[model samples]
Target chain A: MFHRSPIQSFARHGMLVLLCVLAVFPLYWMLNSSLKNESEIFTSSIFPHKPVFSNYTYAFTQMPIVRMAFNSFAVSIMMTMLQLATSLLAAYALVRWRFRGKGVIFAILSLTWLIPFQSIMIPNYVLVNDLGLNDTLLGIVLPFSVSTFAILSLYQSFQSFPGVLIEAAQIDGMSDWSILTRLIIPNTRSTIASLGILQFINAWNEYLWPMLIAKSMNHAPLQIGLRLFVNSDTNMWGSLMAATTVSCVPILLIYLILRRQIVDSFVRFGIK
Target chain B: MSQSLDNTIAPSLSGGTIIVRRRLSKKKLRRFKPYLYLLPAVALLSIWMYRPLLYTFYLAFQKWSMVPGTSPVFVGFDNFEHLFHNKSFIDSIGNTIFYTVGLLPFSILIPMILAVVTDRMESKSKNFYRAMFFIPMILAPVSVSAIWRWLFHPSNGLVNYLLVKLHLIKEPIAYFSDPGFAKWIILLITGWKMIGFSTIMFSAALTSINREYYEAASQDGAGSFRQFVHITIPLLSPMIIFMLTMSILFSSQWTFAYIDMLTTGGPYGSSTNIYYEMYRFAFSSLNAGLSSAAALLFFVVFGLIALGLNMVSRKFAFYDN
Candidate 1:
């Protein structure tokens, strides 16, 4: 409640700063190594003695990174839109309408939250392969269309909406569809946006599912593409770093712009 | 004039009928509207998640290579029998536990202390430190692994380079390639990646703690540590439980991407966890039955733990309300 001593304050600040550095140093190293040549990366120096952009050039030429980025963007955007629409509709229903089996539905959705990807992944792979959707972006995006976390968060936001507003609209003979489209969605735009951004970032960074479903660079997102690059060219640390950095740019940029909203959303939803 | 009056009355009467018709349709729609809205999410989840979960159990008892033109033959308990005896599979269970426990310090203790300390700081410094701490949580895990892979490189890695320069070790250690260090390295990297996330959670939890409690505790002659123990700990216990349960449930998954990118569960299966073991069996070994068996086992074990934690949290968690 009160500052007892300057020494205590100094020590606390020092420890905080030190922890911050430790948290960020690996990322800083990735950026640092990306600018160096092959020779410089092998040395013990922290900074590149002579900065070279050749590694980035090499990364561009060696891999279909542009295509991978495009693929990542497309899948992430599509998944975000789809998840939002589904979540919004579901949340609105669960909150607004009283119905039979609502409790069962909620329990089932909650249980789905605990179902790890590993448990369902094998069968999903089989199903995807059977449907002839393997190595397709649709395969990757379809499985993620119903996010329990998104639905839960949206459910909370929708539940917090003023009941009087909905009731008043109902008395005026306004349709449920119009009430949702005009009043509810417009009011909860920020919440929806936050959830959308979180989902987009998640989809963009998705590695395991994409790794399994996407066979080639054409359908692979940035993460899978980066992994393929590393696996095939393990010895090329420079280009690996360059490609890793490139892959992180879009999400990092989005995070920087929406840092507060993104971080706050995570804190609120605890969605990891 | 009489014809005009009749015309107005006819129009009003028709409008009333139209409204009544719409009302009837709306009533019918509203009865099933919730289900209709929930249909898309429910259908997708059933198709992708719930059905696959059931299929996992089914496949666990059958043999199939996921190849077309072949059906899974029922070979009950054989897959489980083999998985139980398999050395790598058994080791992966231990490794997964090791990771979940090892991550507690990063995900719980350090973050708790950091959150409390930062909470006491001025707003400017607090926000600055919070931003810096959260940077890693936003980075993709694949990129995080790539960065750490370079740092953990045997000869040129910053870790070994620093150790040697500081006279800590005469030679660089092939961290990922060595059996002893590989799992620990994975643990370290996973912990590092999680610290920022847990820190933010802790910070949020810490901020929600009523400051008046601390002031009152101080007036009653309690030191900061005492106040934290008497006040903060009780208030934050729910969050702590929540985080611990999450870490236990998802630790294997958090390490999944990293293990794939950096080690591939390498150096004699030392770094492998249950999740990776499942992946290895399914994709690499093409043994769908064995992988399904592993997934089922993982599901039951962690599912029980999750359920247990849920019960514990309900009982022990102190809600301010």
Candidate 2:
């Protein structure tokens, strides 16, 4: 493509800058509001007259955000690890083995993808109560242990692995376990990492499930805890904002570090 | 060693006994290996996925208060009749449609333009702008709702402050609390958070489009805008349809969170949608039968819309690869 005239280039640049501002200004306002006092927040000045460090401190004491973050971290980590292991094993079986009813099993698994939380909330609540897993981390992670999308993504990656490599491993007198661990695992690190991060983020941001299961701050994830804060104290905008920022910082950092790999993984997997 | 060889020959009725046993064991293991590998995930799914789904459908026909010592009564079509006759249910359906209509343009069109504009920048700058656009997508939705709720606050909010400073309004406008403005404010916030995902999708779609198309357009004396209209748009139609379908499906889920956080279906049900109403009826009001009936209706309507969209997209979408 040829370059446009200088005036045209300038106009294009101006428009791009405008788009960035539109995308980012509300976030900027959020941070600004968090740092301001009640008077400053009410006044709605672009800059706070007096910056308050107490808001950040107040978030810890007021909302039990630390406990909530810890809970979220524990549940997300558990869910992500479980999802990875289960999805990998399932994908491996589907990819490597041929048997009767394999296609039917895959179809049945994919049907679960259409099953939203709203559809299953009533029965899941009943099941959780009957099992006495309510108000427990196990309850939060159990229902989320396996996702059909994760299994499909990993299955696709495994299918794309070179057949010759697996044959070579077999020729070397390697067992199935050895072939899976040494051959396939090393080759699919990028896909696994991307899926792992995605699963972790999904678990971390989940609200409705945790709200149903978690009885207190002990098991409540960050989303539910943030809701608790806004509901409990109407005057604690500063602390509430601090808590919100704290919950978001980790995922934002992960996105920044893994942007390319994650985007490419989704593109290849064709996941919306 | 000498003694053992003699004993081995004497004990074995058949030669190559070790090899025979090994082959038999391998055959047996191979028969069961796939199932063994799938056992853990299958067990979890049975307990978690299949059981709950079946039980939920069963519970739909029974009236249970979700409390102990309450016997479930079988009420076949009564719940369905009640849900169909309820005015709130109808209004919620309308509200959901209104929000979807309000959001579809901002979610699809604005981000497409942003993606095009951002892609025109140098590669290094394009990466930076891409990151900036995707910041909201990574943030927790609850936090995003809280931030927007504050911004849209009638008094002591930045939006009103800005408007007043610009001399656009003499007084502050109550956004979320006013029934007239509540739904639109929710739509705006939903659109804001969604732009990131849509922009990234479109940006990737744009980049994947071949520059040779542009070269051909330029040779024909077509300007950049004309090339975008004729070449880029046609090439990107598949991605456009894909994202549009996803946005429609996702609109219900995303708005559920916002409605839960900010409005709680307030201002006389202005912010209420089917998703929220279902939650309220099932959980708060303990009307499981009515909620199930509502859920079935929602599924039918949304399912038809999705199927219709899929069929329509087949005609317009161009698969470049």
Candidate 3:
């Protein structure tokens, strides 16, 4: 690395620190505002004069927050599991098996990455409506069951796996399914977990599709529920902040726990 | 083909015909197994993704209000003609371009600078800075919008409150309601949400650049800026092109959730992008034909841009073998 003068290094650090504050200040402000009463929230002070727990209490009373959080959690988990399973199977086949139309299939799947969700959303709504899945959790989950990006990333990872190991397993009388599960899957655990976390976070923050399908509170995910809560209770700033905080907690916790893996996955996958 | 034929012929020649038959059948089953593995994902994708895409194109050429028991009617070029003349649609297109151009500073330029700077720092401090920068990228967009909505509040918001205290403004500005401020505010918020992600990507790209190039440049009496320009940038050109293309493509969608939550694309639709406008058409107005047309237009425009970028990237992006 090139050396820098002390003054230049100091200035760089200062700028970076300032940017970091700007990056994190919104979440800080949210947590701070959530703890404040309505009067305190409106004031210009950086810290709450007297932090109160009442906003959270009011938030729980006014909204089906527990239920919504549960809905968000269950939907994200199920979607993650579904995507991982499908992606793993398909990726294994694409990498290990030579089949007719494999190139055509891969090309078609890659094209899905170019087509934005909005392009297909109207027809998808119609499809969901026909299936009578609207206003249900499955409605939100079904459409996202296949992820082209995940499969492609996993396929790339599997391409680097040792073929000798697969041959060794085959000689030991291991079936293809057994080789995939007993060897490939275990070796690529970090990649699988990284993709899973990425999918989970995406599903949790999913708004437009979930909003379209889950019209009622019972099936609404955290993002939609937060929107509805904000719309219906416009003046309850403290409680709204509290509810927003609740919605953000699970994602924030996941990010904190697996920060490196998540970033690595994003970089590897070239996903936004 | 020859290998399989040889297997059958050689087994028959060796007089192990029965055993060969069983093995051949098993080989056939093995050949079919990959298809079985691929079927679920392929089926799901075709029904959910491919079918809807075709249906979108079809619906674009038809007229429908999505009324119950009413079918879509064929209307060739009518939707496109209407969209061309529609004031809001034109404005939304302009706003989409504006968001894309406005995001460049946050998504590409600043992130590049930050990535280069952080790359030279000590390891522990580098990790700390990276984690801090990446925090916003991980936060949910709805919550990010909620916090900013409060921060941009006219009377009681922190931003306005700070401005007044600093004597920057005599009065608080209604950021979301003012047509001039609404689009820019949304842009700024989108940029803030995106910067960390782009920075992380840039950092990853930066680390992959071999240090020997930088050292040799230094020995050649090149300054830091010169080294960065000649060595760092050329090596990082591929990622730079990628980030630029991604920013342009997804900029409209990036601002959608925030626009929905923060302003609802308000103040005379100054902040509305095509994505949100399509949402309004489909859900609010129930104008399925108009929405499909818009979505199709969006796809075609972005698809062409993607194609062009592919060509441009091949020419400009430097790949070290």
Per-residue error for B176 in candidate 3, Å, reads 0.8
Clashes of each: 0, 0, 0
lDDT of 3 by residue, A1-272 (tens): 45568898789889999999999888888889989977787776778889999999999988799999999999999999999999999999999988789989988987775787888898899889988898999999999998988899899999999999999999999999989999999999998988888888888888789988988887898889888887787778888889989988888888788878888877778764
**On a 0 to 100 scale, what is the lDDT of residue A206 in model 1?**
83
lDDT of 2 by residue, A182-202 (tens): 889988887788888777877
Worst 10-residue stretch by lDDT in candidate 3 chain B? B2-11
Query: Candidate 3's residue-wise lDDT over B1-321, tens digit each?
Result: 636775658755677766666777788888899999998999999999999999999999999987668999999989888888878888998999999999999988999999988887788999889888888877777888888988888888899989999999999999999999999999999899888888889999998888888788888999888988999889989998999888888888789999999889888999999999888888898888888899888788888888999999999899987
- The complex in candidate 1 yields a DockQ of 0.75
* TM-score winner: 3
Chain A TM-score of each model, in the order shown? 0.97, 0.93, 0.96
Find the candidate with the highest DockQ and give its number. 3
Give each prediction's DockQ, rounded to 2 decimals.
0.75, 0.57, 0.76
C-alpha positional error of residue A62 in candidate 2 after TM-score superposition, expressed in Å: 1.3
lDDT (tens digit, per residue) of candidate 1 on A97-190: 8889999999988887678898899888888988999999999998998898999999998888999999999999898888999989999999
Query: Could you tell me the lDDT of residue A261 within candidate 2?
Result: 69
Q: Please give, for residues B124-145, the per-residue lDDT of candidate 2 as tens digits.
A: 9887777777677667778888
True contacts kept of each: 0.86, 0.56, 0.74
Residue by residue across B1-321, what tens digits does model 1's lDDT show?
434544555566875766655665667677888999999999999999999999999999999887778889999999999999999999998898899899999999988988888887788998888888888887888888888888988878889989998999999999989999999988988888788889899999988888888888889999988988989999999999999988988888999998888889988899999989999998898889999998888778777888899999999999997
Better of 1 and 3 by TM-score: 3
RMSD of each: 4.8, 4.7, 1.9
